[model samples]
Target chain A: MAAEPPYLELLESVDSFPHIDISKTPYIEDESSSFYQLLLPNDARCHGYIHPSVVHKLAWTASFQVSHSIPRTVQLLDDSDGKDTAAACSRAFYEVIEKAVDSKIYPFLKTMQWENYRIVGAKYPTVQLLRSAARLFGICSRGAHMTAYVRTNDGIKIWVGRRAAHLFTYPGKLDTTVAGGVRAEESPFECIVHEAAEEASIPADFVRANAKACGAITYVAKSSTAYGDDSSLMTPVILYNYDIELPEHIVPRPQDDEVEDFYLWDLEQVKQAMVNRAFKTNCAAVMMDFFIRHGIITDENEKDYLEILTRLHRKLPVPTSPSEA
Target chain B: MAAEPPYLELLESVDSFPHIDISKTPYIEDESSSFYQLLLPNDARCHGYIHPSVVHKLAWTASFQVSHSIPRTVQLLDDSDGKDTAAACSRAFYEVIEKAVDSKIYPFLKTMQWENYRIVGAKYPTVQLLRSAARLFGICSRGAHMTAYVRTNDGIKIWVGRRAAHLFTYPGKLDTTVAGGVRAEESPFECIVHEAAEEASIPADFVRANAKACGAITYVAKSSTAYGDDSSLMTPVILYNYDIELPEHIVPRPQDDEVEDFYLWDLEQVKQAMVNRAFKTNCAAVMMDFFIRHGIITDENEKDYLEILTRLHRKLPVPTSPSEA
Candidate 1:
């Protein structure tokens, strides 16, 4: 065996989130508890977990049924049509929580962005939740991360960004070229197009034409600072990774305050930065995956080649697909 | 929700092998029992499971110590050195079994080729076991599979092979263009190079330069037919997948009896073949992963996109890397 590779630790850092077995975990519905379930109207398929420190403040209205035995199972009591009606009712519930929740008590509320994220794997119908609340409520969040590079005379040079220091999470860390959470009803590709334009100042048409969806990386993540809370979250996320080859002439400028600057670094420099823990945890994982796909890191050189490949795409203990009828 | 995709069933079929609980399972060290453990000398990191139906026939030689309560834990009694000595002893033990055991009772012995596969994750050192005996002892077997494709005016077309009907496993089923089990001390790329020549008649230099190591696919596979036994075997495999774009002038001809014929089919035709269950279970999984990475399978078109990606790279419950210390 050779020396343990530095990049494997990067994967371990991002995936330190513990696995929760829903069958054994305590759930509270009617009473105030730490974990609550978000149930649907007609379907028994979808399941979500939210912290009681947040949801306990909400008044139990008539439109909700709290199941005592089912550990935080809260069913929407909408009498209208099943799918969309339940979605609308769930949306209203989150909106009220977003406005009424005290930021001092639930610090995650202070970081709320008005954007909406649709919970994945919700069959028959789905609900859109506030982006900031997605982590508080343990749901499989979806996002798109694109690696933009230019073919240089030396080799392929990647475009990387230094996140703004004032950001709420992972501040001052290195990040992928373009990455953002998937907005409501948006496809992964469309999300990349939107993020590419907004974050990297790249044109949407160029991204739509050149950005190729390589695959996705799924991991359960937890951090105290990421969600602005003392309670570490079960933040399971699915990031659809992409790669785009840019013409050498096109340079990326920081379009918004989210990014401070952009740099074109060669492979060795990028790998060193990863070893230095300069990149954000998930973004480092994305780059490590990209190198494997492009044949930079291989089974010959890396001792943990197979382990890293498998760990980068860990299966969610929670349901990640629509139920088959 | 939309109708369930047929390809998801293909993934599920290959991964139906049940998870074994090592702690709860009974072990036989002194007496006849079902499960046995192969313990390495001075190293507690690596562990292997073998069915007693096969190992019980071996003579209780003085060169081995079988722990009574440790569930058939057998330690090689070699004092010369730690790693290589243990490997030599293990090899000698299996050689004796190969010569003395009745083929009628242990049918897998008849299919034993002269090839040796090094057992992965053995810490202090490692051992090379007979390829045929790999699944009998549930170790992580490594292999390489390469998908060859051509870029035509019509679009990208993939080259697939149909296995020969007389083959022992997956006879007459579809397969990747080039694939073979990794021999001892052989890297995955070297395995692909060797397999490409022996299986597809491709030149070694061309394969060396053109093949790109995209990623890998892993699964715990079990089937009565694959291993020629009544008791289904726990066959965990890691296949380092590669892709190569061949010029249209180059054609893949069956260089050996392993393959019957090769065909160049477009994307839709390949997908239809997968939906129809034409490919071997693991080979179909490899192709599905290829499609996902090439952007042919999008999140919009495939609802199980994230689920499939994560499932294709399942983390083995068994240790997969060399010990950190």
Candidate 2:
């Protein structure tokens, strides 16, 4: 084991990844707004151009695709002209994307779950989204998660989950106790309660009674798309964090197959597991955030506390699409 | 009173100011970034110029005074080079400002309580700071406040304190149960504890133990400075909100002269007071945030819910002095 760093002497050594600078990533295409990219994992590049006819058919009439490079165009909507078309565009676009995923992406249909959807807007007042499947397609989706822990007499204990092997991504990796994506019109609180019931056998009523609003963690990162090609997908996510002080006896059992097993570990065990990369990368970040907020990882104990905080929040581009405005 | 507007049917009608178009405010000068302007309250103007010598003497060495129309250059630091000079500059600037406050500002400063002195940079880290007196000067200072509430049997109850009639600004205005400026090196949690003890006579230990972090409310507004002139000083504020659930029968009594009286008002009373503008403008926003977050105010019941949420969060500009890279 590596010797403890001078800053984080209060905690054990951590093997963590340095933050990637998302802002520095170039659009790579003229028509692309800094907010999103086509995420053509197959081409090994961003800024892919799509046919203008496809965009028009999808009702993204206001969005003009750059025909420069590959024939993939990004969705850059002008706020005013785009508002009326949002619902129609999302419906049309996602339908094609869904079909593409069903064929191109593997074994995603069974894991599909309904989520309140917003295909073309910044958070609020979604244009005609009843619901949509939330699974492998979430790479391009905006999402939220909740982190929960229990206060013990000695210290605090966090419950971590191991994803079932059959899961599409990060299978068998560690995850948060309760997490779910925000469905259309559902608030973070509502999502958390619903997730608590589905992921863990925890009763919805119990979660509703006990949960407390902590805040949120937001990030935009380039991620892997449908295929594990050299190309990447740029996705935006906002994790609505919650600190639940679970009762000692209320052990969470897997309600669905999303989670394999649960483990209640103290901070030390969590640190060790994190160092071993036992947790999902996103889950690790969330756990680290919880530690920093709770004072477990202070400036005295962590050298990169400031950098960590800075990395945790990304100033998302203002949504200019008429629907978002 | 006339029936509440259909928009706020759940609450009473508000005779409040219309939303100010902050984005329309022009940059004061060529050198000055749009972030800080010579706030012209009710005047259709911007780009005020100030002397370079004043900017230098004020220890804004890393910052250049924009001499367009702005009479006095405001201290807006650029991120890169200004990072290192932050501690020293904040120390120097606040020192002179403090002296100016003592000698020139006004006669009554007994209300000035010690605030952890961090004058430079936008919150988060304060390298080296001693305590400085906190008061009306907070307008020119970065401040944080905690809006604490308790869960009553019926719905929810908030602790409201009427400011003493003798206080400098907004005398006798209603305020949050526990609110104060974050002193240098004092975390929001610590400041809340200290303020709870000083303002409400709430036990520090109890506050430290029970208080929960809900989130924060941030805004940039025009404020008054030492020289009360037509050119308002643009002030930026971030209120770190907290929700504390106190056990029943644990009434909060005013411990200091800051608070005249404390009332445990339920949701209805709080909303009525908010509509009546009994609470300070900022305090009213904070309470509205609390109500909205708690689901007491929803899109179904409130017309301005989306607008309110949008107004609550403002994307502040990055602090960059001319020296910033």
Q: Which tens-of-lDDT digit does each residue in A157-213 have in candidate 2?
A: 888988999976788999999886676667667888888888987788988887766
Worst 10 residues of 2 chain A by lDDT: A9-18
Clashing pairs in 1: A27-A71, A27-A72, A28-A71, A28-A72, A29-A72, A37-A72, B27-B71, B28-B72, B29-B72
What DockQ does candidate 1 have relative to the true complex? 0.74
- The 10-residue segment of model 1 chain B with minimum total lDDT is B22-31
lDDT of 2: 0.53
Clash count for each candidate, listed in order shown: 9, 28
True contacts kept of 2: 0.00
Candidate 1 per-residue C-alpha lDDT over A1-325 given as tens digits, one digit per residue, 9 for 90 to 100: 1333387778888887754444345632324444666676666643566556645555556666766564557676664555467466665667555555653556666665678787677663356777776776677788899999998889889999999999978899999999998887788889889888888889999888888889999888775664656555567788989999999777788988999999999888888787678898899999989999998888877878887898889877456667541
lDDT tens per residue, model 2, B1-325: 3333232321222212122333343443443433333221122232222223223323233333333343332533433353555555355445555554556433333344544555333332342333332222222233455556667667678889999999766789899998887766766678888889999888999987877665455555544443342233344455666777787767788998989999988776776776566786677767765765565655335545444453454433322111111
What TM-score fits each model? 0.90, 0.66
Docking class of 2: incorrect
- Please state the CAPRI-style docking class of candidate 1: medium
| lDDT tens digits, residue span B113-157, model 1 | 667777777663346767777776667788899999999999899
* Candidate 1, residue A271: lDDT: 80
